[model samples]
Target chain A: METNVTNIIIEKVKKSRISEVDFSNLPFGKVHSDHMLVCDYRDGAWQTPRITPYQGITLDPSAKIFHYGQSVFEGMKAYKDENGKVWLFRPDENQKRLNISSKRISIPELPREIFMDGLKTLVQIEKDWVPTTPGSSLYIRPFVFASGTGLHASPADQYKFFIVCAPSGPYFAGKVRVLIEEKYSRAANGGVGYAKAGGNYAGQFYPTQLAIQKGYQQVIWTDDNTHEYIEEAGAMNIFVRINDTLLTSPVSDRILDGVTRKSVIDIARAEGITVEIRKVRVEELVSASKNGSLKEMFGAGTAAVISPISGFGYRGSDYDLPEMKDSYASLLKKKITDIQYNKADDPFGWRFEVI
Target chain B: METNVTNIIIEKVKKSRISEVDFSNLPFGKVHSDHMLVCDYRDGAWQTPRITPYQGITLDPSAKIFHYGQSVFEGMKAYKDENGKVWLFRPDENQKRLNISSKRISIPELPREIFMDGLKTLVQIEKDWVPTTPGSSLYIRPFVFASGTGLHASPADQYKFFIVCAPSGPYFAGKVRVLIEEKYSRAANGGVGYAKAGGNYAGQFYPTQLAIQKGYQQVIWTDDNTHEYIEEAGAMNIFVRINDTLLTSPVSDRILDGVTRKSVIDIARAEGITVEIRKVRVEELVSASKNGSLKEMFGAGTAAVISPISGFGYRGSDYDLPEMKDSYASLLKKKITDIQYNKADDPFGWRFEVI
Candidate 1:
């Protein structure tokens, strides 16, 4: 297996694209690396994976991914430490979550070893794309989608697993101003809420755009039935600090089980801060704001890291949270990144160093 | 404008793909006829559309459609009668509903005339593909997705509108047995529940697959908070017939405003049946079954027309709904199909004949 893998790598290097590309002035997702990893699924098995130059793929209009939304993805960054070594932070977690998402969406499972191998090869081949500039890194997106040509509403027989790399930046331009949507929701019970599926993201566009029209950066979606409980923001797990207690929506079938969400929970515990994970009703937050108990709020995700919410409008009432001098969000973000960049001790064994 | 359009069509046909070929056994969505209609939003304007052959187009991986859940679609069918005529049932309603779904999802709208003209041309091009046999027609899928590539959680400045046709059979093979999901929901209030967004379908796969494992056809999702109010089936709107009245969930933002659902309501009215459109609690349904008031239940959608429900299981209790016979569901299905296939007078003006 090792020698075959080495031969595949040597072949990939021989087949690298001939395009001379400037890394600077590169837009987030515009400039692609020289090589990409492609794997095929047919006859109920994932065939031998191959690496090739970035190119267009032909798909039937009825391919299940385009029609049925049978697709899921993960976003992780490749960081270059001071020693010129590449490190991936808890990528095994992403691979596991991808499988979890696959199981929920009824897509075939991807073995962890295959997933890790694909990621390692793609990153190694595209090492030059990783930016050493401040607040910049290579953004790697691993996705799986159904690729069959039948139109019926069933799982696809053929699937494609591919890894694509993008030159990076802050996902959100700056700080965000969100609106707590009291009416619309993204996912619900028995829904694909916990998975990083494409459909879950697709459903949020119109409503989040509506919020954008109203001058909000994102919409904090509430529960479906009464629309009373605060579930999550569009891309991040939400946290509201009330009276020194961090309150957040409980992880359920209707919300994505975010890795950053778990990290925040752990960081809070490590800092001796009280964190409550239960159904945080929208009314409770409003009441806390009125009572002057609400101190700060932020959103946590892998892409944006930690985005502080400046203000939120709920039912047309604007509520601005007070800024904190010693914010848990900023603290956790630093601690996590420090560990990821190998600048701090990996007390939690979160960082996996790749030599 | 009309003359220019006619001349353009004639000239386009002069240079189109080789049309004289065998097209039987096309296999669902694999084959496309000569022309496909595509319109784009560029410079904040929806440019006039063009019709071209079905081909693969490439996009940046960061396209909002790929990353966010900003995609929505509608399923509508066109049929041919025995007298060598083509007709669409409620095409106007579908166009309007598509707009509604677009508005809810932040997608650009395809003008009514453009939509109708595009459908007519494509159906005309594939008229041979529309089988004239009983229960055979061409399935039309009109969908819009954000086309810009960026990792930001904002609505795309650009959008693409595409209408593709498929040769489809009955969606469900046999009488469907549903599992009443007490823990999951398909849509929620203040959510895109009533919109035919792609994410809404993706969310149902896991639970419905579980239902399939349990020997059920689909999972009937309930309202998210309490799982009390019945929302809809995976792809179709649900209807339950109590002793004499037809009880169905009210059309709310949390339930899809199915075109067939409203048609059934009109058919029930025309048949002098009492139709109640309100929240139908799960408990009330179970009680109705125990008391023999629940005579039958079925799902209404464009694909299946009306799919009868054989039974449902919920909360450790199994209830068997009798296979419908000489029932309102069957009668409405017939009356509705009459207009769809142009077999009867379209008193409701539901059928639009294409010249």
Candidate 2:
């Protein structure tokens, strides 16, 4: 793809931080690349995008983002193929979703050209930061926040858009246990749940912490109106495989429309698997667990790609799934990762090469 | 009242900005005082609180607060009475609620002594900035946000607490027209709606903007599940007066325990007016509005002690409230402000003197 890089202002770092980072034991979301993309929206338009050295940002103490949670972000990853070429998995999807989130939070939508050019230019400049390891990649964080100085309860007049990169290993280490939450909700109906709004994630930390204390790695969030339906798992969209059929909740105002989630569905359907996109009742899952039809459960997102679930706790009872020699989790993860890492054929045109 | 100012570190500004501010026409939350209080929580404890010149704060681009919305805040006021004495109305309540909001969002609870002493000392120093004009005062914003770098979608290890004051005029100019929102919601049951989390306010802006475009000043939110019951008005706790009785929704996990709300209830009850705290159905409001029994409607909060609603839009129809010669809104507002400004005797010990 030919990116319009002429419009983006580039300021390279004096010294690369790659030498200081120990990639062998990389932590998730801690280490950043040498440069970052920043754009300011003020005076009714987005300013020229700038790529500067990764550093701190200064804002007034009463910035709207600090008082009102008028912030939105996206998660994507850049991969390195065997031949040293850099690639981003469905970068357009992330750009689209970021604007969707921005609009929901009352932020002005970012222009597509700026988003694409800024992202591709930054990733190209820092292509060396893309980890060469088998399961590791450079995690890209594109976020926009209210930068207007005010304490009034309204939409901000100015906003700051940022794209920061972190090279890291997997989000979840291994197979995980999840608690089916009966109390507390991540999003509400007619709310900002579908958007990648910052508040959506903040509200989940406390409840997930409670689940972690109960010997669970994450919480499988249910609908706020009734705990009968399953919605999401932690920050990722969840999929439940009962017998030969795969089930996941439909995207609504209360559930995020994750990028990897749609890819998984498309890949699964192309592989001739039955995927049901509807509300999956907790009662059905509990019954399936008792009857031994629950084969596998997993979460899908940019950070994890596909995180297999080992077991789940619900209604004071723990249910474990039988280990399958030919589990769907492994098959789907390999297929998706193959596309992401540019190891397989790009049938769906999902890969965007940066270099 | 005596305060322990021994623990706080003070750094005065070289010169005051008071000369530049137009106190006669001060905008809400835009003109800030000369100094602000800041405290950092790290290494498993809150550091020494500092009162420094109000200035811009620098943070990492990857700070968790920018991405996850792990932020909470409180609204308060420092009122300068006729004798140049500053008083805070139920500041202890604001302190308690701030901690409550912090805990719900997984932020560390602020110690009571620090919150009290910091607020008192800061207000004392900036007392000259507090507007002595009628219906105008210095608005104090006490807020805490995640300051830790990294975006792994968990609770932040470091947090920043700040107290920024803005010398402002009244929040609302005149009676407002509110839209009874049935399509959008501010919060859900078992959600972070009750807390003054930044995300809660962020979600309301878009919906409120839509209402504004439709000729309404604010949105009267309804229950997320059914949209059949009244919840709140914009950022305030709502009250509906039917005939001679005042009806307000009970404080639950979804409704804020507003300081002004409770004060109005107490003052009204003391004045022998009937006050009912229960779930108020939208049907009841509509019926009362049709029957000419809906005498008054108002919103109560720190910014606006009482914002009277002149009319409301519901289901494609608008209902104009009668102009009562002696309305409950005017009466309660005067009684509350009397206590806040030290013009009336305090029977409930709601006023805390800072001078």
Candidate 3:
């Protein structure tokens, strides 16, 4: 059983595409690594995962993912240190969250061994793709979707889970301006908001496009019921710093329990900073901005790590946040990246070495 | 430009699979016709539409639809009359609704001519696949999804729109029992519920599975805010007959504007029945059930045409609806089927003949 679980068929690409890729000008999720990990779930059990060359796949027109949106995904990064050592930061959290999302979307749970082993094997094979440049890493996307060909609106009997890697620099630019959303909602209270489901992201595209037309880079989504409390900013969890207190929305079924957001909280507590997880109302944020107590605002996610909010637009007015020399965003970002790149002591044991 | 707009390259299947299918036991959305109509959108314009054999499509693993659910679809039917003529009921409404859904999900809108001509041509080519059975018809599904490779949480630069047909019998067997949902929600106010988006159906699978486990076939969804007012019943618009008046929830951004639902409303009003489109509260339903005012309940959709509700389960108690000799469900079902089959006069110009 152990051999069966660990036996992964390795199929390398004929010619590497690394030489053609410009590492300095890497676009987000555009250039893929040479190889990927693919696994099929059939007959109520997961088959042994295989390493294959990155390529297109054929699916029937009636595949459930195309019609029903029964899919979930996770995003993480692999960093290469000065000694050419590849490391993954807090991958166990991603595995746990993926299973949670799968359960909520009626997909079968994947064992942790498959996820870890697959990640390790694939990263080791494509270690050259992990850029060593500052503020750059190999972005890893692991997704599962219903591959069965049927139009019935039920849980599919067959599924495909795969992991693909891409060389990426940064998701956002230096700073971002966000619009406060009061009309369109991303997720409801008792919906798939907590899960990393594909449907949650698709619903936001139009609303985000509307915000972009209004000169905002992202939209800070509020609670669907009352549209009062802040939930998430774009695809990431938001944090607001006011009067030395780090405040973020509590993790509920309506808010995604972001790994970066949780790590920031833990790191802040360890560094003797007050962290409060509670309902952060829109009115409170507006008042704080008016009274000059809104010290900083940033978004936390695996893609951006830390996306600082330069200003926010509410109603018809724009409120600009003053720059700080020792902002919490910078402090937390440096601390996290230091641990990720093997430049600092690993206190919480979050690093996993690949090769 | 004229040639580009009207050109449709035809590619018929080498051998027809219709002989192998059992027309009596047709499954919903399983046995597809031999030909399909496909169109592509690229370079800021919709290319020429084409007719091709129903086969698998190759797509990159990073296709936007797989990760973000950037897809929309419409459902209608092709019925054969006794005189061997095929007719589509209210196809213009489906074309308009498909564009509406496309706009909400950030996909490019499909032209009405393309939609109409595509359906007409595909159904004309595979007209023999339309089952002549009383309860069977050729189910038409027109869907548009993002087919671009890269994934960046934005609308794709390319899209593929296609229409497929399947010979299907009734979607549900006999009358179905539904559970009143109070915990989970299908869509919220100011969301994508009004659109026939793929994400909307994907979210309902788990909740409907839970209801199935509890001896119910469907779930009666409620308002996301308070779960007080009834919204949609399963994938169809619901109607409750209370004391000679037909009551249903009014169309809103959170409620789907069902075509069959509209037809039923029109047929009911034409037959001198008082149709009230207002908020149907849960408490009012419970009271109606207890006081014997709830006469009949049914669901309206293209797949099922009209699904009679035998009874409903609320909280921990079951409410059984008494049988009626001339129930509104039967009358409306028969009237709609007659119009669909061309047995009755085409009073509303809802039927479009194909060859």
Q: TM-score of each candidate?
A: 0.91, 0.99, 0.98
Best by DockQ: 2
Worst 10 residues of 1 chain A by lDDT: A1-10
> Chain B of candidate 3 versus the native chain B: what TM-score?
0.98
For B58-91, candidate 3 gives per-residue lDDT tens digits of 9998988888888899888999999899999999
Residue-level lDDT tens digits of model 2 in B1-355? 3458449999999999899888899889999999999999999899999999999999999999999999999999999988899999888899999999999999999989889999999999999999987899999999999999896988999999999999999999999999999988888778899999999999999999999999999999999999999999999999999999999999877889999999999999999999999889988988999999999999999999999999999999999999999999999999999999999999999999998
Flag clash pairs in model 2: none
Model 2: fraction of the reference interface contacts it also forms: 0.86
Decreasing TM-score order of the candidates:
2, 3, 1
lDDT of 1 by residue, A1-355 (tens): 1212422332355544435655555556556676777787899988777778766666766666666677888988888788888788888889999999988877899867668887887787787777676566788888887777666777889988888887675565566889988666777666678889887776777777778889998889887667788889777899988888887788888888888888888878888889999888888888888999888888988887788888789888898877778877678778777877778888777886554
Task: Go through the candidates in order and give the C-alpha RMSD of each one to the true structure.
Answer: 3.4, 1.0, 1.8
What are the DockQ scores of the candidates, in order?
0.50, 0.90, 0.77
Interface RMSD of each: 2.3, 0.6, 1.0
Tens-digit lDDT track of model 2 for A192-299: 899999999899999999999999999999999889999999999999999989999999999999988999999999999999999999999999999999999999
* Candidate 2: residue B125 lDDT (0-100): 97
* Candidate with maximal lDDT: 2
lDDT of each: 0.77, 0.93, 0.90
